[model samples]
Target: MEMEKAREALMVEEEASELVSRLDVRPHRAGRDASFYEGFALRGIRVDHIQPGLLTCSFKVPPRLTDSSGNLSPGAIANLVDEVGSAALHADGHHMKVSVDMSISYMSTAKVEDELEIISRVLGHKGGYSGTYVLLSNKTTGQIVAEGRHSLFGKLKSKI
Candidate 1:
């Protein structure tokens, strides 16, 4: 029975991974001449790719983003996840998406200096409601650090 449960869990995770790949929308770094990311300090966060319903960003676990527990702070992880998810939506072009709601679950702790990868994928989109899933993992160990879901509302913005 345990084996069966484990297999099921693996299958679910695989499906989720596949879903993310299908969304394949690349991050938009060219529009702002890269200065925008620097201004926001998001220049340190490297975007791996963006798919239609998914996006991936990587970050180095710097001291400033860690907590006294010697692990990455929940708030920091949450914010990064939110940013990646929102970036996925805006990556197609240039627009603004506000997160209406976000819920994060910390599965494990990631220490400073750890390389972390965040994969954010859209779960669904209809009307004005859009749902996304974010998976945070320690790149070195491939262990899941956290996961989250976010709902967002988007509005077009004037070009700068």
Candidate 2:
């Protein structure tokens, strides 16, 4: 049943990617302002979908972001996973969310040339805390490279 849910989530992400491609607006973190992903050049990490508690993101792994093993660096994967998971909390609407805790487990290695799909869903949200689950997979093989759980604290930001 978990596998089925994951598969369904992937399908949703694919569709959302197509739709997002048509949008005129880009994410606030798409460029140099993306300090969280500064270690590696994050080409693009798009929020594919956000429905209620679910969120999905697609990413491209650049060769320059690899390690000596010719695989994507664990640090890079961890950063991406955290960004995607936190971004899920904001989705296309909510904002001013900060990650308070992030735990990642690497299951496998992903080659630098691999395109990755990251799917995140809110497990629970209450008061000031939000819990999220994220899965990172190689797009071609559907092999999961890493999974993460994040706890977020959110507050409304005052507009200047």
Q: Whose lDDT is greatest here?
A: 1
Q: Stretches of candidate 2 above 4 Å error?
A: 1-40, 156-160
TM-score of 2: 0.68
What is the per-residue lDDT of model 1 for residues 88-135, given as tens digits with 9 covering 90 to 100?
776644356778999998999999889989888878776666778889
Writing each residue's lDDT as its tens digit, candidate 2 over 54-81 gives 7877877787678888998888887786
lDDT of each: 0.78, 0.77
**Model 2 accuracy (lDDT, Cα):** 0.77
Each model's Cα RMSD: 16.2, 15.7
